[model samples]
Target: MIRTLPYRTAAVLAVALAVAALPLTTAPTAHADDRACEQYLHSKKYQIGPRVNQACRTAYDRGKGPNREAICKEMLLKIEVKPSHAASACRLGVKP
Candidate 1:
């Protein structure tokens, strides 16, 4: 017994699978993923790893208001070493 999806259905499925394989942060922009954040952390002697990445993702997701850049800056400033502020800075056009 052999069954195959219609061409259109197969095309849709393929598109869905391709989209699914993409990194999760593609939508709403990947602000939290800019490499400058990691560089900033490294410059500050913080290790560029999971905790920092998680913090950035959290900050980006939580960011709100007409000034998401400012919101991100405020959030990151409260944390001393763990959160990287470079992405915020990059978005805000300010230095981290």
Candidate 2:
């Protein structure tokens, strides 16, 4: 019974430590993802100022995959860019 108690306590402690460290592990990864998304938007020449920069960043985050054009078009329209311009922006930013 005494030996079993120590083993159980160690198991609980290890689990607690792992749970406590979870956020620390994910925060930097998310921040890095944000930066990478921003850099990609900049490389596409879309972020001309603060307003466009935010929109481009958001578009990149929300629309970086197979449906990127449709997703980005919806988001860009919220900023009042013309439909043609938004479609062109989406088409230009990604490779086929």
Candidate 3:
């Protein structure tokens, strides 16, 4: 039992260290992507209005980057707006 105690202790410590490090490693990458999505939404055009932009931003912040892009692209298509509209809006510092 005494000999086994050291092995058990080392195993427990290794598991604890892994669990503690996992979130730290993954959180920053997730946050950076979220920021990118927010910036993209705030800069996108297409006449999406403030409310729609805000909704998109919120959605992106809530882990919806891929979905947000799909929705925004669909909206642009439905409204007959060009992608350049979004590029211009981003350049002009517009929030819609």
lDDT of 3 by residue, 1-96 (tens): 999999999999999999999988877432323234335545553344654454444434435444555554454445554566533322223222
Worst-scoring 10-residue span by lDDT in model 1: 87-96
Question: Model 2 compared with the native: what TM-score?
Answer: 0.39
Task: Using TM-score, give the best candidate's number.
Answer: 2
Residue range 1-96, candidate 2, lDDT tens digits: 989999999999999999999998877433323244335545655555565555444445544666765776677677676677666655544432
Model 1 lDDT per residue over 10-92, tens place: 89999999889786646554234435555666677766566555444444443434455555455455556533444543353
How much does candidate 1 score in TM-score?
0.34
Can you list the residue pairs that collide in candidate 3? none
| Reference-based lDDT, residue 48, model 3 | 46
Q: What is the C-alpha lDDT of each candidate?
A: 0.52, 0.60, 0.49
Better of 1 and 2 by lDDT: 2
Score every model by TM-score.
0.34, 0.39, 0.32
Which portions of model 2 miss their true places by more than 4 Å?
1-47, 54-63
Question: Which rank order by TM-score, best down to worst?
Answer: 2, 1, 3
lDDT of candidate 2?
0.60
Q: How accurate locally is residue 60 in candidate 1, as Cα lDDT from 0 to 100?
A: 46
